[model samples]
Target: MIAFTAAEIADITNGRLAAEPGIIPGSVVTDSREATPGSLYVAKPGETADGHDFVAAAFDRGAVLALVEHDVADAAGHNYPAVVVQDSVLAMGALAAETVRRIRAAREADGQPLTVIGITGSAGKTTTKDLLAGILAAEGPTVAPQGSYNGEVGVPLTVFKADAHTRYLVIEMGATGVGHISYLADMVRPDIGVVLCVGTAHAGEFGGVENIALAKGELVEALPATGTAVLNLDDARVAAMAGRTRATVLGCTAQSAGDAQVRAGQVGLTPGGSPEFDLFLPGDPNGHHVSAKLIGAHHITNLLAAAGAAHAAGVPAGRIAESLSAQAAASRWRMERTERADGVTIINDAYNANPESMRAALRTLADLGRGRRTWAVLGAMLELGEDSIREHMAVGTQVVRLNISRLVVVGREARSLYVSAVNEGSWGNECVFAETVEDAYDLLQAELQPGDLVLFKSSNGIGLRHLGDRIALPPQAPGRTATEGSALL
Candidate 1:
């Protein structure tokens, strides 16, 4: 972040200062526990906890400042500067935005252009952001959103990560209601806006599926007339939003991406399970082969989304393919596999879960379990609000349609998913339910067999990672090199 004095921050966030005349706040923080030297702890409140309660803890962590809406007459006891605001969370974002504007105006970092690509959708937003950054970086430097940083606070923080040296910026934009995407897009002011797809991911939060479509459309809606909008031609909802964008449209999808300006084809999985495909050049027979390290045919769609965004931003096709094939899975949870000592294969996709993601996971699980009995350990998807039960039920029906031999549903709400599966199928005796990760662990330990394939998935709230770790025993014997070293010693 650009070094800003208290006076500058007052101007940036349009807030009052309760501290001394001259203190330079070097960083902005949301979590008081993570605040340290030169940190400005923003006293924001959450559903379960208030950040103001931890002001003392932040000082212990060496924080230099505290940003608060409440007047801190006794901040002198903590020996740091304090900034008073009507809302600390909003002020933090305001300061971050102003910092970015100043950085961009500096024309620093050898005069390289800052190309920001804002990505929005119901699903595939993170994967597309990761892939897009990798592809664009094949030609030059890039800075991508870290994890699922696609919201109000995350968007500003992502911008703060930018400096003159950042050749490209790939930002993920997420929305639960109307105007969220527009707010993030305005912050990023991206050269290219990508609408990956619109689905029921958070439809309940936005009131309905139609509202969800409108929310995701906000990314392109905020685009300037000269900017480019990358639309997923295969998604009817996303495709419909294209006409609403003032930007030039570049469409992408699988070859069936009807009338796409760019498309991917000849796609399939290797025996090892990575994605392999050819990206069809727009208006030309010329194409480039992509060997992405991600698994499943769904990744082809993700790659095409990233490809179209990168192309609209002027990245070459061959470079995009090389970038896609060169990167490993950006994170372990997407479709990570672990082999247990007892010979059980575990796919740990427990980082997050949604209806679309759950369906795709089940399909992959079935394909990988061709010669083996497959088990699915599922937890509930969050943020669906009133639609949670129905969405889980939809996931359950899809599970029954797949080749899963057993289903262990963990957590409270996910029991609905298991029930739905039983109701949708012929009550396959393979279904079981556990209220907690520990219970799921005990059941798996007692029942798993060699040659069994198991998939564990859930939203972040379910703590499914604990269950995955419990069932994932270490290898019985060390690798040959380690054994040799032990013998020599």
Candidate 2:
């Protein structure tokens, strides 16, 4: 990432070097499949598979070295070039921290500036990261995560993508417990920290909503006094973070009447459910208008958050608006709208979910399916802890209130939603519960019409996104039609 030799990498990671003295890894990766020449592979244990097993595979892909918890032997019975550490994940973080330090030092020596922006929240972190990246890229070179790569290992992998020529690094920080965001902040040390809304996404893991706020605030807490903190004024929990950091605070809100330094006014949705609004910045009295290609009104807050960070990075208001308007949804499975050739519309937001985001998607679905029949194929929202039942019940009630045509709850974990819908007066065929994704797919296939709008939402674990993908497919050929007992589409 910063042209560090094997000796320097071992020293920086506080690990013993077992490789050739002058070897240098140009990049760092965790997956063996992504290894290339001059690549340093970090072999760590994962939930699904142990990365240590792929060390030889990585080396075979032209990797110069591997960072591992145990030494890896080559075909010659000799230890391959490696940096042996107690924990390969932590060693990778150390290497990333040093890479950032080196890039900054080099930029400082060349009188160039590199602005690192850290974004965190219970929901919308990836969307905001994508939006900010688009706005920042218009100003200069920017590096951002590919998708929702905002976890412990993901942050360092994103950091390793930065170099001296990189002008902006947008780091999305996600936390399941206390100190998680703090741990990420300690690595990149962002110059501008943006805190979006703190919601009940991870309330179960953090024990409560208050703990979520505490964890998300760590991003702002890591900023320097000279840096700026862009906070969401609409979310009281995030707004309270103004006192947590020494950095100058810049508040952003979706309301024009608010006292926020940056605000959005005249908000409205396009026919396709995308949001369009007048953007108000800090200095420019007459603000610019931005119509984002991103769907749902919930994106207004995300757009404002991106504008606030872009403003802090010295991007002009007009350029920010232009960049935002030109951008489309870059990440997959989050309000991903697909129009089938048969005239059916599919909204696949099954990437991940929480109470706040769930409500937002349901509302957007209701709005977009105004005159057309609507189908909500939902699954369980995981990690909601003790509030799981109440939250799920509330979503069911909201769906009914929205006047949706049909509700299909998939899986036993999501039984609460089906039962709540029935209890909420949606009886008989109005609400149906399926035991699996295949059952849900069959039910929708038999009932869906050409003009109907279907929405698929759940935590990624539910696998409903694949169901949405299957539903998005055009009508099958006469002989290739799906059968009840056939394999999953």
Q: What are the TM-scores, per candidate, against the unseen true structure?
A: 0.91, 0.97
Model 2, total clashes: 0
- Candidate 1 lDDT over residue span 303-369, tens digit each: 8888888887787777777788887778557777788767889888887777888888888888878
Score candidate 2 by lDDT.
Answer: 0.90
In candidate 2 the C-alpha lDDT for residue 205 amounts to 90
List CA RMSD, all candidates.
5.0, 1.5
Highest lDDT: give the candidate number: 2
TM-score of 1: 0.91
Question: In candidate 2, which residue ranges exceed 4 Å CA deviation?
Answer: 481-489
What lDDT is reached at residue 286 by model 1?
A: 79
